[model samples]
Target chain A: MKLLKEKVMAEGIVLGEQVLKVDSFLNHQMDPMLMKEVGSEFVRRFAGEGITKVLTIESSGIAPAIMTALELGVPMIFARKNKSLTLKEDIYVESVYSFTKRETNEITVSKKFLNADDRVLIIDDFLANGEAAFGLARIVEQVGASVVGIGIVIEKSFQPGSKLLKEAGYRVDSLVRIASLENGTVTFVEGE
Target chain B: MKLLKEKVMAEGIVLGEQVLKVDSFLNHQMDPMLMKEVGSEFVRRFAGEGITKVLTIESSGIAPAIMTALELGVPMIFARKNKSLTLKEDIYVESVYSFTKRETNEITVSKKFLNADDRVLIIDDFLANGEAAFGLARIVEQVGASVVGIGIVIEKSFQPGSKLLKEAGYRVDSLVRIASLENGTVTFVEGE
Candidate 1:
C-alpha cells in the first residue's frame, strides 16, 4: 500500500479537482512488479473468504485482478464492455455509466462462468463514483453468486464511491485513498 | 506447449470452421496458473532478446502480457482501443480491424511509455488475421522502437496471420498452432 501511494503521489497527474492520470505506471503503462505486490496485498486482505473467482472489468482491472487470482490460485473473469461476436447469448448483463467518458456501456459476463456456487472478489484500478463496482456486483448477484469483498487499487475518498459501497455492506479495501485533488496537487487520507 | 495444446483440445470450442471460442481459460474467464505457465513459455522462447518492455492490446492480451513482463522484469503497456478522457494527446495511433467483432478500433498508446531506445516484445491472446499484432508493431515502429519478437498464445495456422508476420521477417512464437477446426473438432499442427 505504501508503494502504491508513493507511486501515485510521484506520478499521478491531477486535473481540474478530478481525474487522476496515472498512465505512466498504473493504468496505461503498468509496473508489473508493483502489480504483483498489489495482488499479494489483496490476497493478504481477503485470504479466508473462500473466493472462487476474481472478477473485474476489462482493460485496466485485468492486470491487478489476474495477479490476485494467480496468488490465490483462482480463476479471473473480466466482464466485457461490449458484446462481442463470440459472447452473444446466455449472459448476465449490467449497464454502467462512466463519469470519465460520459457514456453508458453495457458490461456482461457469460452465465457459464458464474453461478450460485461461486464466491466473487471484485477488483478495479480506480473507484470514483462506484458505478463500475456496483455494476459488477449486480452481475454477480444475478447469477445467485455472492460477493465476498471488493479490492480497489486507488480510491478517491473525496468522491462517494468508497462511502457508497461501505453503506451497502460490502467490505471495501483500497490500497491508496485520495483525500483531495485540488489546485493541481494530491492529498492522501492518512491514519485511516 | 504440450499443456497448452491439451487445454485447447479440451476446452476450446470451435464455432463453425472459422471461430474458436476459448472464453473458458484463455480469454474471458481466465485460469491464472495456465496464464502464468504461458508467460514462462513466452519468456523461454523469447529469452535473451533484451526486451525492455512488453506491449499488447487491452482486454484479452493483458493477462499474458503482464505475466511476461513480470518474469522479464520489465513494464507492460496496453494500447487502449478507445480514446478515454485522460488519454487524448501525444499518442501513437493505429487502426486495427477485428475480424471477430466485425469492427475497426483505433488503438492508441501514450508517447511517454515508448520511445526510440526501447526494445519491445509484443504479446497477444490469439493470432488470426494479424491485424492487432500489425497495429501494435506499427505503433512500436512509429516511436522508433524495435520489436524483438511476437508471442502468441494460439495461432490459427489455417489463417494468414502467421504467414504474413513471418514473411515480414518477425520472429513469431506460437504456443499452440491449430491445423484446422472442421466438423466441430479442434486439430493442432503437430511437429512444426
Candidate 2:
C-alpha cells in the first residue's frame, strides 16, 4: 500500500480538488512492475477467501484485474460497457452512474461466465462514488455468485465509495486512500 | 504458440462461418496463465527491437499488452475508444472501423504519453480487417513514434489485415493464424 500511495504522490494529478487523474501511471498508461506488486498484495489480502474469479469493468479496470487474476491464479471476467457481437444472450447487467462522466451506462457480463459456483473478488482502478463497484456487486448477486472482497488501486476516502461498499458488508481494500486533495495537494489517509 | 492454437481449437466458437468467438478464454473471460505464456512469446519475438513502450487498444488487448510489458520492463499505453472525462484534451486520435461492432469509433491517447523518443510494439486480441491495429499505428505516427511490431492473438488470415499491415511495412506477428473456417472446421496457417 505504501508503494501505491507513494506512486500516487509521485505521478497522480489533481483536477480541481475533486478528480484525481492517474492516467500517467495507473489507468491509461500502466506500470506493470507496480501492478505486479499491487496484484501480489491483493492476493495476500484475500488469500484464504474462496475467490473463484476476479471481476472488473471494462477498459480501465481490465489491466489491473488481469494482473490480480494472474497473481491469484484465477480466471478474470470483465463486464462490458456495451454488448459486443459475439457475447451470448444470457447476461447479468447493472446500470452504474459515473460522476466524472456525468452520465449513466450499463455494464454487463455473460451469465455463462459467472454462476453460483464462483466466489469473486472485484477489482477496479478508481473507487470514488462506488457506483461501478456496487454495480459489479449487483451483477455478481444477479449471477448467484458470492463477492469475496473488493480491491482498489486508488480510492478517494472523502467520497462515499468506500463507505458504501463497506456498508454493503463487502471488504473494501484500497491500496492508496486519498483523504483530501485540497488545493492540488494530496493527503493519504493516515495509518492506512 | 501450440498452447494458444490448442485453446482456440477447443474453446473458440465458430459463429456464422465468419466469426470465431473465444470469449471464454481470451477476451471476456481471460485465462491469466495462458496470457502469461502468450505475453512471454511476444517478448521473445520483439524484445530485441528496443521497444520503449507496449501499445494496444483498450479492453481485451490490455491483458496481453500488460503481460508483454511486464516481461519487457516497459510501460503500457492503451488507446481509448471513447473520450472519457479523465481523457486529456491534447491527444493523438484516429478513427477505426470495428468489424464486430459495425461502426466507427475514435481512439485517442494523450500526447504526453508518446513522443518521438518512443518505439512501440502494438498488441491486440484479434486482427481481422486490421482497422484497430492500423488505428493504433496511426496514433503512433501522429506522435512521431515508431511502431516496431504488431502482435496479435488470433489473425483471420483471409481478412486482409495482415496484408494491409505488411503493405505498410510493419512487422506483424500473430500466434494463431486461421487459414479458413471452411466446412465447420478451422485450418491454421503452417507457421506462427
Candidate 3:
C-alpha cells in the first residue's frame, strides 16, 4: 500500500479534481512487480476467506486479479465488457455505467466458470462510483456464489464506491485510499 | 511447453475446423499457476532479447503479457480496443479486424508509453489470422520501437497466422502449436 501510494504520488496525474491518470504504471502501462506486491497484499488481507476464485472485469483488472489468483492458487475470471463470438449463451450479465466514459456497457461472465459452491474475491484497479464493483457482485449473486471480499488497488474515497460497497455488507479492502485529488495534488486518507 | 500442450489436450474445446476454445485456462477463465509458468516460459524463450517492454492488446492478452513483463522486469502495455475518455489524443492507433467477431476495431496505445528506444515483445492469448499481432506490431513501429519477438500461448498452425508472422520476419515463439481441429479433434504439430 505504501509503495502504491508512493507510486501514485510520484506518477499519478490529477485532472480537474476527478480523474487520476496512472497510465504510467497502473493501467495503460503496468508494473508487474507492483502488481505482484499488490496481489500478495490482497492475499494477506483475505487469506482465511476460502476464496475459490478471483473475479474481475476485463482489461485493467486482469493484472492485479491474475496476480492475486496466482498467490492464492485459484483461477481468475474476467467478465468481458462486450459479448464475444465464442461466448454466446449461459452467462450472467450485468450492466455497468462508467462515469468517466459516460457510457453503459454490459459486463458478462460465463456460467461455466462460476458456481454456487464457490467463494469469490472481486478485484479491480480503481473504485470510483462503485458501478463496476456492484455489477460484478450482481453477477456473483446470480450464480449463488458468495463474495468473500472486494480488493481494490486504488479507491477514490472522495467518491461513493467504497462507502456503498461497505453499506451493502461486502468487505472492501483497498490498497490506497485517495482522500482528495484537488488543485492538481493527491491526498491520501490518513491511517488507512 | 509439454504442460501447456497437455492442458490444451485436456481442456481446449474444438468448436469447429476454425475455433479452439481455451476459455477454461488461457483466456476467459485463467489459471494463475499455469500463467506463472507461461510467463516464465516466455521469459525463457526470449531471455536474451533485451526486451524493454511487453506489448499486447486488451482483454485476452493482459494476463500473459503482464506475466512476461513480470519475468522480464519491464513494463507491460495493453492497447485499448476503443477510444476512452481518459486516453484521448497523442496515441498510436491501428485498425485490427477480428475474424472471430466479424468486425474491425481501432486499437490505440498512448505515445507516451512507447518510444524509439524500446525493444518490445508482443504476447497474446491466441494466434489465428494474426490481425491482433500485426496491429500491435504496427503500433510499435509507429514509435520506432523494435519488436524482438512474439510469444503466443496457442498457435493455430493450420491457419495463416504463423506463416504470415514468419513471412514478416518476426520471431514467433508459440507454447503449443495445433496442427488441426478437424472433426472435433485437437491435434498438435509434431515435435513442436
Q: What lDDT does candidate 2 reach at residue A192?
A: 72
User: With candidate 1 superimposed using the best TM-score fit, by how many Å does residue B119's alpha carbon deviate from the native?
Assistant: 1.1
B31-67 per-residue lDDT for model 3 (tens digits): 9999989999999999889999999998888998898
Candidate 2 positional error at A67, Å: 1.3
Evaluate every candidate with DockQ and list the scores.
0.93, 0.89, 0.91
- Rank candidates, TM-score, best first: 1, 3, 2
Candidate 2 off by > 4 Å:
none
Give candidate 1 misplaced runs (Cα > 4 Å). Answer: none
Residue-by-residue lDDT tens digits, candidate 3, A1-192: 889988998999997799999999988999999999999999999988999999999889999999999999999999999988899898889999999988899999999999999999999999999999999999999999999999999999999999999999999999999999988999999996
Tens digits of per-residue lDDT for model 2, B1-192: 899999998988878667988889888999999999999999998857999999999899999999999999999999899898778599888999988899999999999989898999999999999999999998999888999999999999989999999999999999889998877788898765
The positional error of residue B20 in candidate 2, measured at the CA in angstroms, is 0.6
Model 1 accuracy (lDDT, Cα) = 0.94
Local error of candidate 2 at A37, Å? 0.7
Candidate 3: list runs displaced more than 4 Å.
none
TM-score of chain B of each: 0.98, 0.97, 0.98
Error of 3 at A122 (Å): 0.5
The 10-residue segment with the lowest total lDDT in model 3 chain B: B19-28
Question: Model 1, A67-169: lDDT tens per residue?
Answer: 9999999999999999998889999999999999999999999999998999999999999999999999999999889999999999999999989999999
